[model samples]
Target: IQALPVSKTLQLDLLLGTTQRFVRTEPVRPLFKQLLEQVGAGLGEGQGLDAMAARLAAVEREQFQPFEDRHPFVWKNLLLNEFAYAMFPKGGAADIERELMGIVVKFALIKLYACGLMAHRGADFSLDDVVRVTYVLSRAITHNRRFLPNLLQTLQDHDALRLDVMTQFVL
Candidate 1:
């Protein structure tokens, strides 16, 4: 597989930020820490991103399977709720919503990429795969919401929509 254009520094920062955010959240913190430790232990030798992603997926599945079995859409609900919060963050300037939404989109893209990579392992995956996965995930996440109308309303409501942030998320 060809290397993605994302910088190692940016990847490290995203990983650290994600880890810290999850670790700070109560109830899930212990489980998140345990998953991280499990991933660390699984990365014993010359394993690469694929191995790490697979291990993380395995650990997450093992940990969440029972809950998932009981509440099939729990993960999707959690993700959508997070995205909704980003769209309308409290106690911050309204202008920050774009940045927060961009961050959420970035994390969502990373997840989609990881899932695609795992599913298409040894297949002829390409940048088109990324685009397709992004589209599909976006559709799935936004299916229940009137996302486009709300986004348009937000654009009309806010003076600045932060095209730079949107562009950053796109590219």
Candidate 2:
């Protein structure tokens, strides 16, 4: 694929292919660290979305940290959730297990990207994916009331939306 210096458009194809690489080399730790770092540095310098996105887009697989230490509780919830489960394919136990691992990796990357995008005020990343994640997180909060307050605070701090607006949207 052509590697362009452009916005933070996710290379779904590349990401899907990344699962194969995980078997060979160790996965990136602090998952998506490169992307997250770039977002922080860019925003600190008061850069715009286009600039931030371009910088984020240029990150290669080698730059990412391994996903070896993510919280099991969070990942488990994400996998079993209705929205995430729909993406799983039907298969035998072995095949299902393999596919489930890939889905876990994919979701981790998505969350990494989502968190990076959320870090910056008015910074647009992949809105469709972000919204989908937002939906899942919202559902999570509903399922467990404790998450609602923390999520609201995060939204307000990130400037994704006003706390009131986010409350209505999530509800």
The candidate maximizing TM-score is: 1
What lDDT does the true structure give each of the candidates? 0.42, 0.39
Q: How accurate is candidate 2 locally (lDDT)?
A: 0.39
User: What would the TM-scores of all predictions be?
Assistant: 0.32, 0.29
TM-score of 1: 0.32
Clashing pairs in 2: 27-66, 28-65, 28-66, 28-67, 29-65, 29-66
Model 1 stretches with alpha carbons more than 4 Å out: 1-4, 17-28, 42-79, 85-171
Question: What tens digits encode model 2's per-residue C-alpha lDDT throughout 45-136?
Answer: 24544554444443322122222132335444555773455456667666664444334333544454444444442334334545555464
Which tens-of-lDDT digit does each residue in 22-102 have in candidate 1? 345422324334433433444321355556555445533543244345555644654566567556555478656655654
Model 1 weakest 10-residue run by lDDT: 1-10
**Alpha-carbon runs more than 4 Å astray in model 2:** 1-77, 82-84, 87-89, 122-171
